[model samples]
Target: MLSIYIHIPFCVRKCLYCDFLSFPASERDKEIYAAALLKEIETEAFRYEERLVDTVFLGGGTPSILQTAHIEKIMDTLKNCYRFSSKPEITIEVNPCTVDKEKLSRYKAAGINRLSIGAQSVQDSELRALGRIHNAADFFAAFHMAREAGFDNINVDLMSALPGQTAERYLETLLKVTGLKPEHISAYSLIIEEGTPFFDMYGEKEGENGVERGLPSEEEERRMYEETGKRLEEAGYCRYEISNYALKGRECRHNTTYWRRHDYAGFGLGASSMVENVRWKNTARMQTYLDAYGKGKIHGNVKEEIQRLGRAEQMEEFMFLGLRLTEGVSRAEFFEAFHEDMEKIYGPVLQQLLDNGLIDTGERVKLTSYGRDVSNYVMAQFLF
Candidate 1:
């Protein structure tokens, strides 16, 4: 089975902390992009026609920003072009301000089984700081509307360590979101990427005595991260992945495909694809992409940065990616895929990690809580 990701690069406005490939566009620009996206999907389907699609993730600059007809057309195109599994999981990323009950209801009709609402915080001040177009009240209304629109499996996206945010304030946001009992939650810490407004405000600034200004200190950020697992588990959610919590049987299947290194195809501007160990990304240049698809030349010039993974590189990916899960990598599966015993490849490294109490060894090797705190370091050890 294969998974598919479609990117929608339109938004009402850009958020200060965001560096994603998204921007506000006119209706005509959206219409043009949608047309090109449809053609690309149609052209690509010929290559993966035999593969059964199990999951479809519509990610974006707020996919909910699209008109209902546009979204319906896109879903229709996908349904007609691909052979889907018996019950496919289709998810769309939504901005609270962009969706209403009618829009959400149409989404359900379009076979979108899951909703991922981006509610970064439940504080109006934080929302304003992030330059989010919606307030806390708007998120509540959107959630209620989604539930009313018949979406049972939903995920709420939250962020901690925001500008002027404290652990107590983050905890309150968590409690408020959990009170609604969404099936899944994704909580991420803020990262100040270069070129983003946040990079200038927080990334470059140094507070008194070498402290960071306008954001939570590293100590408080650590507290927020640690408390996330504890509090979510207390609220009946399981931390299946490092940054994701979900109720039993409600984890995101689409994202799981990525962590498991399964084959997935991405469509639209700046989309990426991996199939049969070969990976490539679509051209990020919007005009270039549109022109290629518009002219019906879907092959060579559309793709850039293609690479086929060698055996060692594939093994490294399998190790590091799978380790992100709480259950970690399976020794048996690794041997099955690579035909090499896990212990034989890195027995010494494993021994050191075991001695340091960073990992638990057995049929399935998993990180200790301490190891997860330093996951980058632990994952780096697998690189050969």
Candidate 2:
């Protein structure tokens, strides 16, 4: 089985904190980009012919911003290019403001079996602070509209530790979204990535080593994370991944493929893929991608940057990505895949983590409750 990812790199307006390869484009530009994206998908599918693509994820700069016709064409192209599993899990990432009853209905009609609504916060004030176009009202409307369109498998995205956010406000977001009973919830803590408005505003300190302003304290952030797990669990959504909670049997299969280190192909601008030992990301520049599409080949420079991971690199990724899940990695599977005993190679590192209560050193190693709080450190030890 294989997974396919399509990246739609157009947004109505780039959010303040977003640093993805998304841009504001006119409708005509969208049409051009969509045509090119379909071409890439066709070319890649031919390279790996006849394989069953079990999962397809349309993620973006808000894929909902694309016209229904564009989406339908993309779906049609995938079906024509490859064999689909009998029960393909097709998902589209949508923004609250970009969709409506008709658009969602068209999505269902186009074979999108899942919806991931980017409802970052349920509070209007927080949404405004985050420079998000949509508000609480918009999210509710979108949620109901998705349900009305017959989407049973839905994932609501939320963020905690936001600027000017209190513990009370974070809990409010959790309670409100969970009350809606979406099949999954991705509650993430805000990270101030570089080259974004957030980094410019808060990344600089007034004086030497001055404390960061407007953000919650580390202790406060910890509270928000812990409480989120408790609240979502009580609401019947189990914590599956570090930031993902889902009802039983409704996890995002496409994302799970990444964690399991399975092969996946990414299409469109700035899309990346890990097929066997080779890993590559498409050109992020718009004109570059268009030029490549025109020439019927990915640009030479972009293709030249491809990384063929060595054995150590593969093991590092296998451990780091697999450890993000609550179920963790199996030693047996690791040996089968890498032909190296995990215990023999990493026994001391595993012992150190276990001694500090970061991971459970069992047949299948996984994070302890306390370990998940400091998962970064645990995963870093696996790095080559």
- Please name the candidate that would achieve the greatest TM-score relative to the true structure: 1
Clashing pairs in 1: none
Cα deviation at 363, candidate 2, in Å, is: 1.0
What Cα-based lDDT does every candidate model obtain?
A: 0.91, 0.88
lDDT for each residue of candidate 2 in 105-158, tens digit (9 for 90 to 100): 999998999999999999888898889989899999999999999999999999
Compose the digit string of candidate 1's lDDT tens values, residues 1-384: 999999999899999989999999999888888888888898889889899999999999888888889989999999999999999999999999899899999999999999999999999999999999999999999999999999999999999988888999999999999999999999998877789887776664344321446688778889999999989999999999989999999999999998899999999999889998999998888999888876555553588899999999899899889989988999999999999999998798899999998899999989999999888999999999
Candidate 1 ranges with C-alpha deviation above 4 Å = 204-212, 295-300
Off by over 4 Å in 2: 204-212, 295-304
